[model samples]
Target: MSATTLTVRQQLVYEKELCERSFKDFIRLAWPHVDTAEYKHNWHVDVLAEHLQACTDGRITRLLINICPGSAKSLIVNVLFPAWLWAIRPKTRVLSASHSFDLATRDSLKTRRLITSEWFQRRWPIGLRNDQDAKTKFENDSFGAREATPLKSITGNRANFVIIDDPHSVDDAKSAAMRATAVETYLTAVPSRLNDPDRDVIICVMQRLHEGDVSGAILGRPDLDYDHLCIPLFADGVDRPPTSIGWIDPREEGENMFPARYTEKVVRGYRASLGPLQFSGQYQQAPAPDADGFFRREWFHRYEPSALPQHVNYYMTSDHAPSGNNDYNVFRIWAVDHNRALWLVDSFRKRCTMDIALGLSRDANAKTVIAPEGAFALIRKYKPRAWFPENDGTWAAIKSMVSAAMIETKTFVTIDPLPTKGSGDKVGKAVGYQAMAAMGQVHLPVGPIGDEALSEYAMFPAGKRDDQVDADSAIARALEDVIPAWLPIIAPKKKRSMFDDDDSRATSDDCWG
Candidate 1:
């Protein structure tokens, strides 16, 4: 029935039920300012709404959404979703955070405005506590509250739904220290605030930034089991698969995801202005190109786990970082085959203090001692021929610590300090590593860690973290001359003309030396 045909109480109940049943309807009812002519609501909106509705139904406890900016992501998720939650699930508390406090407060204010709007109250009858009405935080009469904060510790605040919107700013994403801080906040600070850890949901929505950004960290970890909803600006037909919610990008290949909003012309302009790297991350939802960069992804050859040779020479190379820095200590095991191809056997990386990095043994009791495993376990397992530690400021201190620990544990292994190289020289070494991989002389063991190493290589000099790449560069420098001079370069056979003679044939010496 139309609004005019219904009784006063009947109309109220009808509107309330309509808003609760359809979040899209609720947006239209609550916000009269949306210009349909310019807004051009697309199919992706319904897809997003469906996934969010699924969140409330407890089907998804963790969600990470990567979408191009200006797709109304913040408006749909940050502003509308929270207020809709209050309408249906009246006592659901929400904790929202952004990279900056001002940004968080802005969304909070919009949500507050929606909740207090005449249309919203007429239907849902939810009221905000008079004394608790604030921009950053507010409490409803039903005991549900919405609190917004910068990406930092939210002391004593608890919530049923934790939402992180754009946790890393563009500039902050380029800095390893800042990216680490953002990831730490997401990993350590926010998860604990959930009122119901098992039942409550956490949603993170942002454009990808770096390989170590929060989105990257979430996707890399399989234990989290996040439901990822990626909406790139252009449809590659496979960027978004069929989600459990039965919503997928329906656009064909080469079509714009939201053509009316981000047209072909606009997208082309973005590509030209943002450059390949930024445009790929921000618009394509992929931080690095698959086959382009200083280190091409296709060049990192993979080997079957079962095909590994038993008797190959092994060596360990490391990249170290002192405490208080965000860098990770990387330990990599490399195997050199008889053909001199370098195989990445194993790797371990962690952001830890010197004690943990070294795996120092400590006294547990009067008769008991506990030996933590870090690099020590890898050394014991692989028994590498030598350990090459980068010759940086921390080299001497690390060598001293390793020596003292070895003497105590009676585990003797050769320790060699890598030749000191300046920051500019490391890039050149990375180029050498890239060249080695391109020549098929570098092989990677097939696994998730290997995939991660390849991505790091592909985004080298542009990625936030480079500890893995640095270790690979160290190994490349040490094994630069391992390729045998006797190895034959087989060139394609050239069809001989009747007039051609043996003297015109190319010799093996004419190949690349």
Candidate 2:
């Protein structure tokens, strides 16, 4: 060969070596039609590639990578990284699994294609063994094997490198049993699949699904000791991994992780499509299911106590649960104006003995106290002008209990059972209140108490403590009876033409006269 040809061949060999040593470079060279061929290089992909390199070098034994959906996580972690591993160490064994067998097989086919590609074969020369050549499971001549299996079907397989792409699907993640099963498999079956317990590599790549999902289960377990790389879709200014881990986020606050692929408009579209809770979990990687759904914070209207109209009727509503491991006893004082706008004045909620609960009720000092069937006894001691107990077929018993309590305390207070109306369910009542609140018909005093109430409203059915919501809903239900009289009806103003006399614009009082 000529001198120029020899130099070109040497440079080509140098480039081949670079590709062999680097996972990203190997991806570019082997799958030029995929990674860098048409797609712009993303920093998150580089980060994932570097982390996988660390895993390959035995710097990290157990790794957990959480990235948003459509961030090319599976393409990088499952397809490129495994193929790159085999390029350098043909003897390395890899066990790849996903939520489903089809997904695992799809990735397996991609990796197989990369391994069998002309570029990869020419550069690395790791030929697949003739006996073990298959789509889902393939072995190289150097005793290395890559097996693709469903997450639940990995019974007696072992590998040096185990890659679980997404152990739970979106639907599977929603189910507690499915999440538990995935975690159990990860804890029990997956660990046993390690050819060497101490030295084998296990990398889990997935989006945040739920608090009880496999990723959560693994992270919660300190004994497992996984190096977590959480790449949220948006940069939220919260430092996820400690600086000691050397995983610095490249994006600034509010910047998209992969803006090249998903534009700001596209991200917003996703947010609109997924809703807040799903978007928070799947995209932002914040699996706070309680914080996002049911009631949005913006829907609430906060006002000063002075904003209450002068002729407002003040009342208190209660949802009672007895002490000793029951739901909290809650009382919310409210005022309804002539315009039928409901204003939350004051509130108290806690798990207390009946004595303290009664003390709380008296301390409220409202004109009327509306209690549920369970709270009639405790609330009667407050001597409210009108005591309305929620009557759901147990009115007589509730009345008897209130009368007995009044007799015992030597104080008589009028008791009236509130008839069940308009789809009598807690959630239904809450939904009604939510509609009113959304229309700016409900207002809350701006303070800590209001903040607490709004927090409960925001959490709703998903929250751990919903006593505040119950109290609010009860008050809303009570207001349905009171608001008809309170709702203002303004007389229609008479219209006048420009040519009409000034007397035509006179007030309705003048017309009545």
Candidate 3:
């Protein structure tokens, strides 16, 4: 019966049944008490609710939702979903976590407010156990429990449903250590806490903070089989792939995710307020900008392996952190062709202690230091003419080690000390190579190596690491020094006088030669 035709008691029963059957109905009914402001309903709310209900039905065990901030992700997934879930299955256990314990507790408190409200108890009547109820955790009469904790400190806790909300703070996401810790925690700690390995649910909700954030980790690992729901602030016309439960984002291209609140004007304002990079990550749900950063993506030219010129001379450049630094050790091998173009043949990048990265010796007795196989393999295959290590205090050690390695392998190559500049000129060092790339003279071999090098150049100074690009600069310096011999000089054509006879005119090539 319609609400207008039903009695007061009948209406209450009808509403309770609707709340139980539809998660969206639960959100609409529970929104008022949780927020002082009025609830502005939107279509994305239904999309979120549908996927979440699929989680409840055991159709989706792993779900990742990446949405713009202020879209009520925490409210729907963290606060309201748990309370509503308890109404449906009071025996369920949930462990909600955030980047900070305080943030987790904040959502926990909101969830508690809704469960304890008179409206909730009158319908569902899943009373909270008075003795077990607390700020960070609580238990219900049906043995259902909810706990809150930070992502880093989830030891000795198990749950049927693990909710990770905003595990990386926007401010701290820039730190490599912080991003690594978040990814590590999600990989190592998050999975072990599932009470039921076969049927438990893991729901991660957050904006895209970094390329290596927890969301990135989940999508990168195909073994996880996560159902990802990525809804940026503005739709780009690309239909989101259907979830296991068959829910796809319905917004068309260029439509705002939540048009009820964020209009085109408001989105424009946000783009201006938060610069391109920040807006791209948070609002667009993209860790990198759509366009290029310091280096244009189009400027990177790809070369086929079989098309490489045989007359090219190869050179290798190595860059690493000085003493007491933890920068990555990067080695790049470039081939300079007869036309003065630089082709990136191969590269090796690793982050470790100096001793482990570049071992001190290659002797079989010393297990701590062995031949650098990755670098040595390139040397053996390409037979670079010279190798350039930064001209620092350790250059002599590097030279001696490579020389010994070459002798053992019977490979001939020269080891040279690369010139250096002041510490503040890291970006300046890459300028020469960047200019060459802009002119399409620098070529990168197509594969994982090329993809990685292009990504490093795309992020450049703002990226997490720059050892690869810095090594490119060294290659540029080497090419400048050696290109003159292999490349033919083409001087500009000389101007001719109008009175000169046609037969007696000297050929244009003769004057320049």
lDDT per residue for candidate 2 within 37-58, as digits (tens), equals 4666778767887888888777
Model 1, 1-513: lDDT tens digits are 567899988988987898899988776666563223345567888778888888999888899999989988998899999999999988999999999989999999989888887777787778889898899999998899999999875657999999999999999998879998889879888889899899999999999887789998998897988888988787756655555666677667767787777877887898788877888889888787554557777776788988787658788888888782688988898887777778899877889887777666577553222244567777877888778788789888778778877777667678777777553565776777778888878889888779889867767766766899998888776665333312343589978799976666376675554
By TM-score, the better pick of 2 and 3 is 3
Question: Residue 292 error for model 2, in Å?
Answer: 8.5
Stretch of 10 with least lDDT, candidate 1: 480-489
Off by over 4 Å in 2: 1-12, 33-37, 174-180, 209-212, 216-224, 268-272, 287-293, 301-430, 440-513
User: How far off is residue 218 in model 2, in Å?
Assistant: 4.4
What lDDT is obtained when candidate 3 is compared to the true structure? 0.82
lDDT to native, each model? 0.81, 0.74, 0.82
Among these predictions, the greatest lDDT belongs to: 3
Q: Pick the candidate with the highest TM-score.
A: 3
**Which residue ranges in model 1 land beyond 4 Å of their true spot?**
1-14, 33-37, 236-254, 297-390, 393-422, 425-455, 462-468, 471-513
How far residue 68's Cα lies from its native spot in candidate 3, in Å, is 1.8
Evaluate residue 302 in candidate 2 and report its C-alpha lDDT on the 0 to 100 scale.
Answer: 86
* Candidate 3 ranges with C-alpha deviation above 4 Å: 236-241, 250-255, 302-315, 319-386, 391-397, 405-421, 424-441, 445-452, 459-467, 476-513
TM-score of every model versus the real structure: 0.67, 0.68, 0.77
Clash totals, every prediction: 0, 0, 1
Error of 2 at 512 (Å): 8.2
